[model samples]
Target: MDNKIVVITGGSSGIGRALCNCFIDAGYKVAIASRSVEILEKVKSDLRSEGHEILTVKTDVRVDNDCKNLVDKVIEKYGKIDVFINNAGITWYESNEDGINIKKHKEIMDTNHFGTVQCTKYALPHLLKSKGSLVGVCSIAGEVGLPNRSAYSASKFAMNGFLNSLRVQYLNKGLQVLITYVGYTSTNIRKIVKDDSKSSHFPPGYGDAVKEKGMMTPAEAATHIFNGVKKRKRSVRSSAVGQLTVWLNKLFPRLNDKLAAKYYS
Candidate 1:
């Protein structure tokens, strides 16, 4: 994978960060894109100090022009984009009870679904040139409508449909579109979850470490993603829960809904 150019959004932390590390260790040129310049710079500095050359581009995937710029900048440096990972997404643990937060839902949808579409659209031409891979870091929430995650689920479901359609459209053309269904993992995402009023706050009963319990580590999930990329899997589940959720959603849709409510309601 030496010289392989991999671009990851939301690469400052969590699964994206792990993916960055994996690609760096594999001797691939990496570009981490995100809106947070401070965090992105910190991650880049930390990695570079360890002798891994990386590029941290300040990008907001939600912006159409920014998406185009992301592709343009990568191509400027690498001449081609070997892999583009659509990992930049946001969601809040608000109300799946009283109602959905319109403000929060729009934000989630903009960043997760439409954002992925825009980036993929901008990168498709380059990907076609390289016959490379397009990865969508969707969540199990997108696969099955779990309680407390309506917006997250909607965005992910939209992403699945969009990318799946593209996968079929480009199949004979040698492009690989991979979507990952991820279960809960230890990440800073929870720290940024918003309340019903749209203010970011930790949810009730939430603990820093407990939010990570019984969940796959981001590094572990990143390994699965990397392997899925290497194997050219069309779709991958990062955890057993994600796999089982798919099965249950198919065979027992009502049961899945009820069980999800029982656990998360």
Candidate 2:
């Protein structure tokens, strides 16, 4: 995969940033897109010290035009795209006093679901040409809905559905589609956990315990992601605990929910 042109969204922080470094270490020409161009530039400069070819593009994945421009600019600079990683995402712990609200639902869905679709629309042609891979950084939440994450769960569920259908759609075209159900990996995402009380429907210390248990570091998660892409695995689950969740959800969705409540509630 040396010199492969790889594009990753949400490349400014956490798993996205870790992926940027891992791909560069593997000798791939990497382009990272995110809203924080300042932080992105800092990361690029730091990596350049190690002699990696990295490009930064400011992008709001929620916008179709921005996604288009990201792809266009990458191809313009690198001439081809070998892989596209849809890693940009956002989450809110609570939405309303009742349960999940339409406002938060729209925001999360737009960023995590539609944002991925928009990027795929722009990158599909390039991927097809290169016979490349399309990887979506979904969550274990995609497989099993969690308390206080109705909207976030819905968005990941949508991503999983879309990618599953897309895999079948592009099979004959030789496009490899990977949908990953990653579990809790310590990243800045936890810092953004909404003050659920402000929204009035907090999940009663939902994040407190889970944050300590079964959480891997960003570098650890990125290593798993890199391996999945390199092996061209159909689906990647980060941890043993994560794989158990995926299987249990598949085997008994309702049962998994009851178990989540037992543990998190």
lDDT of 2 by residue, 1-265 (tens): 3389899999888899889889888888999999987898898888878777688999999999999999999999999999999999987776445575788799899999999999999999999999999999999888877777889889999998988899999889988898888777767675565433355333333354336445777788888888888998889998786687668878998888788766533
* Pairs of residues at least 3 apart in sequence or in different chains that clash in candidate 2: none
Give per-residue lDDT, candidate 1, residue 64: 94
Residue 89 alpha-carbon offset, candidate 2, angstroms: 0.5
lDDT of each: 0.85, 0.84
- Model 2 is weakest, by summed lDDT over 10 consecutive residues, at 201-210
Clashes of each: 0, 0
Against the true structure, candidate 2 has what lDDT?
Answer: 0.84
Error of 1 at 179 (Å): 0.4
Top candidate (lDDT) = 1
| Candidate 2 ranges beyond 4 A from true positions | 95-98, 195-213
- TM-score per candidate, chains pooled: 0.93, 0.91
